[model samples]
Target: RVKETATHKAGAYATVTVPAGSTATYTVTVSSGGTSATGSGSYTAGTTINIYAGSRSGYTFTGWTSSDVTITNASSKNASFTMPAKNVTVTANWSYSSGGGGSSTNATLSDTKVEFDKNEVDDLKVTLKSGSYNLRSIKNGSYTLREGKDYTISGKTVTIKASYLDSLKEGKHSLTFDMSGGTDPVLTIIVSDTTKTDPQEEKPSVEDPVNFEDVKSSDWFYDAVNYIYKAGLMVGTSDTTFSPYTDTIRGMIVAILHRLEGSPKADIANGFTDVGSDKYYTKAVAWASENRIVSGYGNDIFGAEDSITREQLAAILMNYAQYKGYDVSMRADLSKFADGESISPWAKDAISWANAEGLIQGSGSQLMPTGNAQRSQVAAILQRFIETITK
Candidate 1:
């Protein structure tokens, strides 16, 4: 039996080394001056050490602590102590396990400390901008933005620098910036085409024929009917009859004008009481009346749905010609027409103007001044109107 030592004084000290990949167990005995106390410990090679002090019947055991040492096992069982990589001070403490049993032992372990080195940075700021537009602002870190992949702020320009971007794929790209903050203006960039054509003209499609059996076969009305139908400017009643000979109403004429000039600008005046804002032809009629293209019958009442006469159609064509900036004031006299008196006082000047512009011509020697204007006549007038505008 090994002689027991006193707990009040240093008990027994021993140092043992186990080979790598192996383990060993040892017994540490505590003595209370003359009495011996029991304890056991186990250690593994390579990186760890376990110290255990066996239970003493009247006394309890406390664990170990060091700056570098980590306790792997619970502190409740045997007091386990882990050895540090470098030499340092450590402590193992204990007191009485029973109410008045009393206790003692162990001070700091000596020489255990370690050292190492590395690099770090502080206070870094990153910004992104494009052509007077600021994108993002970042601070306090190393910012590694890709050339083209990462965009940045530089003064007024949100620059997508060329370094990381592919030159082959380089072209103007439109960027829409959210300007809600009022800090930057929204920007759009077009890379390739600067001019875009009208969508309607881009794809040319054939026009549908205005279904008038008699006039569809007529050479004079063919171009007019085709042009209006193709542009979706006109459509026949049903699939068969255009009712070309039926007189066009004043409202219908206005509808045609609304379609023809692609619905030109119009303003409503306070004088017209019958014209309501919600009416379908209100704007069209207002435009025609204001521009002197069409007017009322009597007492300022525009007969909007009344059939239009040849003289009325002539006046409309003349006003349209004048609106197109054509000079047509000389051809007022229809001396060859037998019923020249039948021409309305309000229509004479416009009729003369249309005749002077060569937009209106008599069938043979007849001026047809009082004749009701047909749908074919209206189509012819529209065709001439289109030609005038194109020129």
Candidate 2:
């Protein structure tokens, strides 16, 4: 039996017996086109449970919904709601992104401090993305530093000159950069005094994504690095460095591809003396070898550390496409390129397959097939590869 208590009555109260809690089950399921994730909950009725919507690379979570109307509020991709009256199963829907770049209008660098002495001819770099040029101004209460005369901008990297530092007195300094296409930077440069002996390194109160010494926003592959890193496909050699210009190894590419394929089981034995199951790249090598995506150098040896050429990347990616049942047809004329004949015999078909799909644009007039790809170049190509497959 239930009883109505107070209806907007002040100081009025009524005693009643609350119903016992019932166990409710919730399950999360995806139809397709999403990284597989597990979501299950068993909670008492009327309890609030949070449902987090997750997505894979190149995909976005739409929302969550269930058939039963008993479950109210079918909105919010990541939200909490009351337990339904009965068993409920929620479906996660996903949609692909257009794979384009987005720049911030008000993006600003986090506040930071630096220690430098006068007469020290050195460079102090600050992280920035491509967009705005022409520094508006630099102010620090009593003094200011001019852009072209005091500092220089190279891509997304900002280098403050020692000539400017020599002019400033020792103390805390705050500078505001007025950027056009990019976000303004809110950085603090600490001019170390001539007094004392050693100066401690300045640290950020919180970690910033753009703090990588080598990765500035102005670089062409900046967005791609963030995309791939966040998607769990790649990582930096260190927290402070991405080494975007470093040459990538063949084994590394195989491992990245395997991760993109959801790290499937290694159905076939990978016959490579150089790569053992104990190594981290072992599973990736196995998957690549089983699917004919890549083969070792020769004599049961996989040159895991050898530099991977541009043509090799093309071939492996093409093989991956075919393995995934994607069409690898070609209709483009490769003979038009000046260095077409330089392509290796075995890699011709793969290169042709990729080029016809508008995936591999030649370097100037040359195909540069044998040339190795830089880390930055790999990120750009990988981004395009995912975009192409999704389309």
lDDT of 1 by residue, 172-237 (tens): 322223332324322222222223558678432445445556555546677776676676667776
Q: How do all models score by TM-score? A: 0.43, 0.46
Best by TM-score: 2
- Name the runs in model 2 displaced over 4 angstroms: 1-210
Candidate 2 overall lDDT versus native: 0.66
| Candidate closest to the true structure, highest lDDT | 2
At residue 330, give the lDDT of candidate 1: 60
Mind giving the per-residue lDDT tens digits that candidate 2 earns over 314-378?
Answer: 98888777655355666467798899999999989888877787667777778788889878778
